[model samples]
Target: MTKTRALRLSGVALLIVGASMVVGPPASADIPFNVAVERDLGLSPRQAEARFAQQDHASAIESRLRDTLGAAFGGAHFDPSTGKLVVGVTDPAMTAVVRAAGAEATEARYSQRELDGIKSMLDETDAPAGVTGWYVDVYRNRVVVEVNRAAATRETSAYLDRLRALGPAVRVAEVTSSPRALYNVRGGDAWTTLAWRCSVGFSATGSGGSRHFVTAGHCTQGAGPAYGYNDEQMGSLGGSTFSLFGDYGKVDVTSAAWTLAGTVNRYGGGDIAVKGSTEAPIGASVCRSGSTTGWHCGTIKAKNRTVIYINGGAVGGLTQTDACAEPGDSGGSFITGTGQAQGMTSGGSGDCTDGGETYFQPVNEALTAYGLRIVTS
Candidate 1:
């Protein structure tokens, strides 16, 4: 979404009193003023306002569920667009308990049978020809396989054959793909601070050049006169806003300190080597990293989602994944089985300890928005 620039300033005036004779002229009170002024903080006031609005909506729903469902409700999450509450219940008995309490409840069950079927199909097949990994999206009720190099002649034929064998129950989709690579942050790399804990790429509109990275926009101002990782001068923010739609901030590249490498750390006791830059399908499994949460994995839930932010702004076209994240993880990278960079961390409801749904901004969109490219092996 496009954001416009705005500034917020708060001023306070104080009065002083002293014991003075009526004859003495009253002394003028010293006016004390403190301004918490944020300049070019990155997000436009409209975007910030949107985020606040979303937060209010979510909070109101959550509060109502807690008050009504009470102890019976395991938890509740609201979808802003429909304003529907996905209330979680601990057991079948709790279903009745929830309705009795005056809130709507639905059966929130993950199908082990369907999961096993998908896993079996993946294990048995040769994965067509170029396919990397297969994902079973429970939320979407579909299966997506990641393919390589746009699905060659034989690859496409083999993929169809495999799908036939997997059965019609498993509707299959193919995503032409590549692998993701990893790079270490150099001392001088430029990025947007998603949070004190996470940051991402940015471009500086100056002669110094620009670097690409990921970070949370809320961590810094929407319009930034940003600094490098080493505190060296870098660039300013190009776009920034936070929302349930997936909060992220972008910086215009000012210097070229970022160098792409050829690896993506899976954090599951292995790594995926980079080959090309291909996107994973909707149901594909993906992993991510951030300053707060080192690494975590989950399946893609949906794509092109428009999430509303707590602050009253909305972000369109976000990737929703089951991967969990925290406050500090905003703007971290999300990679797929073949190592392709899928998106960057935005925000989510849960933590690493308990697990929750997370959202991300597709990397390709960022590249296009800032006129940059993802360097691959």
Candidate 2:
């Protein structure tokens, strides 16, 4: 496969093709990709390649299954244990159908629609700060509401009761820290405003042929002019949203000196070519690049998670991952080993040293929201 070629300019370069710790073989240009997955995820390059193909096959057929099963469609996830796709269905009759489609089928208590409805109700109601976030766990076939154990109080308990009353579809999980937006007043590769810094996500183009780069909304929201780590003005915020709508922003690359290449900086490891923006399923391996943490690999834990930050700002429709991130890592690139674009780092509690859950705003959502096309190799 053809890979993105690096573009060097004025001692600054748009890097292309870096390795990641995920289950997938990189293109021919990314030999380090296999080695990275082997070292971090503990899989041989061959094994990782096979698993990536498997997940891609599963993702490809999922839409057809959803249409065929209709309301009986509970949810679908990649089963790492079996190295196959396991689709949940509320109807027993759908089991054979799923199997016929080459996926394992399991019984589910609630359909995806039912569980989403429950989560939607929670999103509409204001929750105590003790509530960190919530998401539909496809494997469990339940909507999980995560709470900060120490932050919980009588008021939080009452709120939990109301959530539980929504029925058995709701499950509570206790976490130690609350989620927050990851803007440091900082790194995929270090872009900055006057007072804060964040990483560049993906490069893209507007419908009118304008060059731009995408990042976390919190990084660009009222943050003013964006600049490269070199302190050169790159552009201005074109669009941004950090509320229930989602956490995403676009920066028009107004500076001719800067290039909008479809690549992510892998720090000293080189770069990773962003080939596409196909969302991976939960349980799939993924890796992210940031200026603060460099590159860290992890598995996707959940999808469509709604995180309520400690500052009272809430961003819905986020994908949760086991990847570790920190302040200033916001807006970094999250990609699969195959070089597929995943998302931009939003925030989460914990550090790279201790390991913690991190959330990302899906790249596809950001692309769609802005009617922009991702620049790909």
Candidate 3:
């Protein structure tokens, strides 16, 4: 293709990823993760627990594969049904290396390095209109791009044509309604000050050692003095960022009555333990707790994605999921298995009623970006 044509198609890979977890409330235990799995996936409590245990083991093997394969590594994910680690390798020779680590190996067409470079080219393009989002899907070994329509216009068609020149690594998907950043602070929540209501994501300490609770940046934007759910005034909004680089913010909690806990409220059920923020692999089961949806489980669809919201400009480097969320659920907690903090709810297409796709700002990325540590037991 000509240079001009290549430039037209050079938007981000924009792929949709697939992974699964659960929505729960089980009867109660040291961890309620199994309960969610059982509830959402139709698995028995014992089976759900076993699946998580398997995922943990898969995660360990994945770590080994990462160190062993290095640049040969394409990507890693869990087999949702079997809970076995699936490692993608650019070289067929590396299959033995991954299988030696107790993971299923699959040869991939594109190397992770090449994929990353292509993604960088896509990012360099001006935001093409009507394009909602995109990400890299390792399972498909392609960058999946989501468009509002297949044939929106001649320009978009030309753009996609150029994108195809980059190789078979880019695929376009047509989607409904655009992604939006949900900002709603309301009553009867973790910490809602104004009429708008946003849920708390995770409580942490800033680099300077001040206690604060993290949430969606869009939530804290224009937020007056924040108040606890009990209607007591807490500290004001501190460091916050909106849909630009990422979507995350922190609210200083200086009140004596409102001590931050290492647990996420499940709304109608048990509190989720906050073990750590180590992100789970793709296709692992993940659960989100929002005031609106209560608790919903799904799989990690994709990572390092960019979702263009209606009002929140363009927030990049997000994790996509089929999990459901609504307006008041903004900034709620997304956790994997028993207790790993995944991300804060950004936005999605539909609601819990009919099911929808949502995106999150990965907790680890947010923590690293703000130099904050999640308060954990």
Q: Pick the candidate with the highest TM-score.
A: 2
Worst 10 residues of 3 by lDDT: 12-21
Query: Candidate 3, residues 68-113: lDDT per residue as tens digits?
Result: 8888988888897767999889889999878778889998888777
Candidate 1 per-residue lDDT, tens place, 26-128, comes to 1211111000001111223454344324434444454665566444444444333343344555357767655554445665443324543565545554444
Give per-model TM-scores. Answer: 0.44, 0.89, 0.86
Model 2 TM-score, 2 decimals: 0.89
Models sorted by lDDT, best on top: 2, 3, 1
Candidate 3 local lDDT, residue 144: 83
lDDT of 2 by residue, 1-377 (tens): 01121111211211211112121211221324555566567888688878777777777768789899999999998887787788999999889999999999999989999999988887898888588889999989999999987988899999998877877889998988887677740125677665466788999998999888889987777746777766678888788889887899988889889877878766555777888988788888888887676777788889889999875378898999988887778889999878889999989888777789899999999999888999887
Instruction: Give the lDDT of residue 270 in candidate 3.
Output: 64
lDDT comparison, 2 vs 3, better candidate: 2
lDDT of 2 at 304: 89
lDDT of each: 0.46, 0.79, 0.73
Q: What's the distance in Å from true for residue 44, model 3?
A: 1.7
Full-model lDDT, candidate 2: 0.79
